[model samples]
Target: ARPRVGYYYTGKTGGTLFNEHMKKLTVQEFQSIPVVINDSASVYDAICTMFLEDVGTLFVVKQDSILIGIVSRKDLLRASMGKQDLESVPVSIIMTRMPNITTCKQEDPILEVAHKLISKQIDGVPVVRERTVNDQTVHEVIGRITKTNITKAFVHLAKDELHD
Candidate 1:
C-alpha cells in the first residue's frame, strides 16, 4: 500500500509555535525556502537564477502581492525544449496557474503539511495568510513548508520516542 497522507492537524495555535521554532533554527531545520520569480521576469533569467540557486521550484507572483503560479525545474526544462525563445517568453506563460497550485498556511501542523506533500505528490507547499484589511481581503505569503522539513521533524520525534 502507498503511504497514507497523515491528517495530523495539531491545531492552529500550537502549530504556529512549532513552525516559529523551526524557522529560528538553521535554514535546513525548516523546509526549503520558497523561491520566487516575478511574473514579468524572462523565462531565461528565471531558469538561470533557479539553476544557480540550486532550487527545484519558483513561486510566480504579481506586483500586487498576488500569487500567480508555480514553476518547477521540470517545467522550465520542458519550456526550454519548446520552440518558444527563452528570452522573449515570460515565466507566466509556462507557470502552473494559481487555482491549480496547492498551498498551506503557516498555522498548519508540520505533520499535516507532510501528509499534504504525500497526498498531492508535491515536494513542497507555499504558506500564505489572508487578512481582511479595510474590508478588503489580501493574501500575503508567510513562508514555505516542504518534505525536508517534515523529515527533520520526524527524525527528532523518533529520537525522542526512542529515548522514552
Candidate 2:
C-alpha cells in the first residue's frame, strides 16, 4: 500500500490501541475483595482491622454488608488524638458517610474508575451493587478498586501484549 499525496488514514499506535482496550475493561475484572468494618464498630476496632488486614481503607457496612460509610487510616489517627476514648467512639462518628462517599459498580468501565480515583484523591472506592432495602436504594460492598489494582491491570495488559 502506498500513501497518496493528499490521503490520510487515522493513525493507530500501540498506545492508542492500549487506551481503547483499557476503556473496555470493567472494575469487576480487576477489583479486590473489600476489607470491611461494621458501622457500629469502635474507632479502636477500625484501627486494629486496618493493621490486621494491611489495608489503608475500610468500607463501613451495616446489616447484610450494606454500605453506609468509609473509614481511612487518617480517620482513625485523628480519632485517636481526640480526648474521647477510642473504644467508645463508633466508626460512624469518624467515617465519611453516604452521599459523601464515592462508589462504583461492577459494570463500570475501568477507565472511569481510574479517573474517579485520581480526581477524588482517594486510594480506593467501594465496588458495590444496588439493592432495595425498605424501599430505599442501598449499596452493598462487594469489592474494592485501588491504584495497585489498576497498576496490576496495566502491567498484565502490557505483559500480554509483549507476548503477542
Candidate No. with top TM-score: 2
Clashes of each: 0, 0
Candidate 1 ranges with C-alpha deviation above 4 Å: 1-32, 133-136, 162-164
Candidate 1 lDDT over residue span 5-72, tens digit each: 85555556866866765444432345555678788999998898788877777888776556778888
How high a TM-score does candidate 1 get? 0.72
RMSD to native for every prediction?
A: 10.3, 3.5
Total residue pair clashes for candidate 2: 0
Encode model 2's per-residue lDDT on 1-164: one tens digit a residue. Answer: 65878765668886888788777789989999999998889999999999999999999999899999999888889888889999988899889999799999999988898899999899889999999988999999999998988898888788877887
Candidate 2 weakest lDDT stretch, 10 residues:
1-10
TM-score of each: 0.72, 0.88
TM-score of 2: 0.88
